[model samples]
Target: MSDLNITHEFGYKNNPNSQAFIESFHSSVQREFVEYISFNDIDDVYNYYMSYIYFYNHLRPHGSLKYLTPDFVFYLFNDNFNDFISSYDFSDFFVSVKK
Candidate 1:
């Protein structure tokens, strides 16, 4: 890190709350996605995770966002939020993909 001119920051020692969000995401990924997949190689892992990330952010409805997708929430808060909400029907927008 010193040679690369990068500063490594550490969370407060013994403070679990500081790492709660990262822990939660890791747990979710392990339980929901990683547990089910058998990867052949690093490329396979990378490809699978790339698709999963797209599904996670664009398709999956998160409980924390009141069942709205992260992408939807992002658009909802954008400058044209009202225009988007008025023109788009999210109820029938979802397409089911078999894993």
Candidate 2:
């Protein structure tokens, strides 16, 4: 689907193009984390997963986000996508990152 079309379909009122992106984020984290972590139960997994999120948001530099971490990229992408529109298409915003 076209970016604008898909954006409308999955978007919320404030950010009409946010749902798909959020879903894609969950999926990527799930694939990279959910399947990889061998936690005995939910608590252990939650603890480790929370740490991983900290790394992703505060440390990991994402190429798609202009080599910025999720913390940086979050504001960048949401503020205005015109800067990185070429590298990140709408679909990519919904696809799992390569493991």
Candidate 3:
């Protein structure tokens, strides 16, 4: 890790709350996706996660984000907020899920 200039940081000792968000995300991924599939190789795992991440950020609406996709909220705040608001179309921002 040192040779690669990578530094690993751990949560505060015995402070589970410090890692709550990541732990929750891990649990969600395992329960919602990983449990249902078998990976053929490392590349397959990587490809699966890449698509899943795109769906998670761009298509899936998060309750914690007021039912908005993360990509929507991210651009809403990072871009010119006022311009984004003025040109916003709610119909395009949401995706319909099929049962």
Candidate 4:
């Protein structure tokens, strides 16, 4: 369903957690696109969002992910964190200490 249709069907609720997440997402959007770019129409806005989503998930490097794209980390780890721990060099984070 379209976002407009959803808005028409549902009334706003006083959900603080939902509101906080939405506010954070909007702040990121404002900083990333709305501040520097202008959309020509609904199509333009949709296309821009699609491109941004691809870039954000597949191309952009995140600090929290240690400068890796979400897709890269997702596929590499693939829910098998044990393999990641065994294969990847974590020497920087894990040091052998002499007691």
RMSD of each candidate?
A: 5.9, 11.8, 5.0, 10.3
**lDDT (Cα, tens digit) per residue for candidate 1, span 1-99:** 899999876778888678877777788799878998999999999999999888788778878888888778998889988887788667645667699
Give all TM-scores, in the order shown. 0.69, 0.50, 0.67, 0.54
Output the TM-score of candidate 3: 0.67
lDDT digits (tens) for residues 1-99 of candidate 2: 585566334456786357766776787698878888799898998899899887666666666677656754665658565565555534423435697
Candidate 3 per-residue lDDT, tens place, 1-99, comes to 999999987898888788887877888799877997799999999999998888787777888899988877887778577776787666756677799
Per-candidate Cα lDDT values, in order, are 0.82, 0.68, 0.81, 0.68
- Candidate 1 — what's its lDDT? 0.82
lDDT for 33 (candidate 3): 76
lDDT tens digits by residue: candidate 4, 1-99? 576565433325875555665566677678887786798899999899888878676666666789776666885767786675577544333335599
Candidate 4 achieves a global lDDT of 0.68
Which candidate number maximizes lDDT? 1
Q: For each predicted model, how many residue pairs clash, with residues at least 3 apart or on different chains?
A: 0, 0, 0, 0
